[model samples]
Target: MNFEYMKNFMDSLTEWIIPGNSVVIYKDGKKVFEYSSGYSDLEKKIKKTGEEQLYIYSCSKVATVTAALQLYEQGKFLLSDPLYEYLPEFKKMYVKDGDRIKAAENPITIRDLFTMTAGLSYATNTPAFEKARKLTDGKMDTRTVIKCLAEEPLLFEPGARWNYSLCHDVLAVLAEVVSGMRFSEYMKKNIFEPLDMNNSYYHTPNDVIISPQYIYEIQDTKNIVELQQKEHTTGVVKRAYGNELVFGENYDSGGAGIITTVDDYAKFAAALANSGTGLNNNRILSSATVKLMKTNQLNEAQRKTMNWRRLRGYGYGLGVRTLIDKAESGSNSSIGEIGWGGAAGATIIADTEEKVALFYAHHMLNPQEEYYQPRLRNVLYSCL
Candidate 1:
């Protein structure tokens, strides 16, 4: 497969919007291509190598679901089991009606968490979150915070629609409860240790050298020229930590809390791409379960809620986007291309059918996924 076109496309991204970026591609459990472009620190003129550790933000969801699915493989829980069976705090859930909150007509099920149909909300400023903070003295422990989250009402009835919320975070705490380990611990023993992903973690390692991330301050989207200017795009990312989503040292943010290098995450991606088998020939999941993970879990009405620009012609699968329509997505890739992205320009694409996987990332907060994600998929497939 020729990667010249992929290189050119990545180069253009550096020239225009992306400050710096890197990508890793694996075919049949082998690293076939890896490249980097642009500057990690634009003001310092530091070239961005593909090895820089990055905060993968929401890409953590992919790992969260994988970790939880490990427990599923052990017959720990069923998809249709009521969520309250594991987390007693959710025994009674409330839903936000038009003008007032009311008791939820349906109970949330384990499947709802996997499919983003649990009606949970991503809003962190809710009274429940604040209560969690005060109760834990800002430690925001996964179980504590999630239990407090149950105090808030859901956005809709469970299984009614898809909403990108704290569903994965809820799922993470469930994994912790089932395994009798902290969310981070469970991930380490099951997902990271088995896959040999030593660099991936819930907390940023003190020794790993990471580039100072940046944010593209959009002066005004109406004025497109400003978006291309250096002053508008390059600034030290103001966050105090590697990931703002990680509320405290004890908090394992299942939604937006993974710090790892491109290759580190690519190992996980490649495992899924190769039908849950890693490069070392260790199987993390059965091929049958991997197929279920990528299968579209959204129905027609539920799909209507997954109307993000980048997710056109796709259906929400088990914590990932499963491609169902190539024409609608304008993609050349196969129909079941499954993966997810992060807030700061991390994209995961795994095609189990083709035994290929890709992890592409730029350490910028506002990486334009709408423009780059679909095109990157199309371009990579073109090269193949």
Candidate 2:
């Protein structure tokens, strides 16, 4: 339980690499290590502290999946349920053939959304994705988003390939429709309140004013320079396609829209490490459901064709990615460790076998920035 090495590492990291807002590592549902560096608002000289919060972009997907898992345990919905069953707007969906989007051979199901195999996509750099962005009104609500995507063809048939898309946002809306509750309310009642994750929320409340932060843009000469800062008065900003859009009060996105603190998210990661039960003795979900959520759900061929060069055996299950191979991800721990990161530099990985969890939260949007996944895995396991 010695964090001297970790503390030293954090100090060096702040001076060298991305100046982090906060970092914490929980072992067996307990916080043995913690650190906060830099400032939440560089202009106002506001410092980041243990109590301060940050938006954890895609990291919120884990909460969305957790909500879906609770519903699954209660027999509210199955993974195999067709998207059209809950949101009928997806019934007439199709993919672009040549000039026009053609009808798909089969309809997209809830499982496809969970696995990220649904033909829908958010990145519009490619042809199909560009078409998808144009057709969907650039929003992530269930009916409108899916209906807009329905007009455009999927990048590929369902369950055929892996494409990181807006499937999770669609899942969030579907979870609410199936559970008969608002998305944010569902998570608040089931996860946030139960786990005592008080500082986390999907919609930014009026009382809490989110501050602006700077991100470094690397130049061709490898020089890291500071970029612009975005000020927020009320709600969090989520970028899709090329537009920066704000979510409505009722809008809930399953894919990426969660703001939380290091302490609060540590509780979440630790609870999942403890099998759906928090350290405060609250059972947010059943142990069986948590186990099911962490298992590998991707087929052999689909796992191999993913664009993520470092990820080989990783499978998208519920909201987290399961480890299918120890070598590809370079983890020495158990094969069952499942987790993912946000667009901004927020990450959490929970190992069920070792009963350990690690959390890193910052406002940086570098998806490729390397840190505590494979590197921390070796260090954490070596100590054990």
Q: What is the TM-score of each candidate against the true structure?
A: 0.96, 0.84
How does each model score on lDDT?
0.87, 0.69
Best by TM-score: 1
lDDT of 1: 0.87
Lowest-lDDT window of 10 residues in candidate 1? 232-241
Q: For candidate 2, lDDT tens digit of each residue in 1-384?
A: 666655565554455434455777777777777778766655465777856656777788888888888888888888888888888878877776677766788888888888788887785344543444455555434445444545556777788877887888888778888888878788898899988888888767777655453454443332223211212211222222211322333446677677778888988999888888888989887888888888877777776656564455566666688877787767676788888877767778888777888787666555334443455456655655
Question: Which of the numbered candidates is closest to the native, going by highest lDDT?
Answer: 1
lDDT, candidate 1, 296-336, per-residue tens: 99899999989988899999888899999988887788899
lDDT accuracy of residue 38 in candidate 1:
89
Candidate 1 matches the true fold with a TM-score of: 0.96
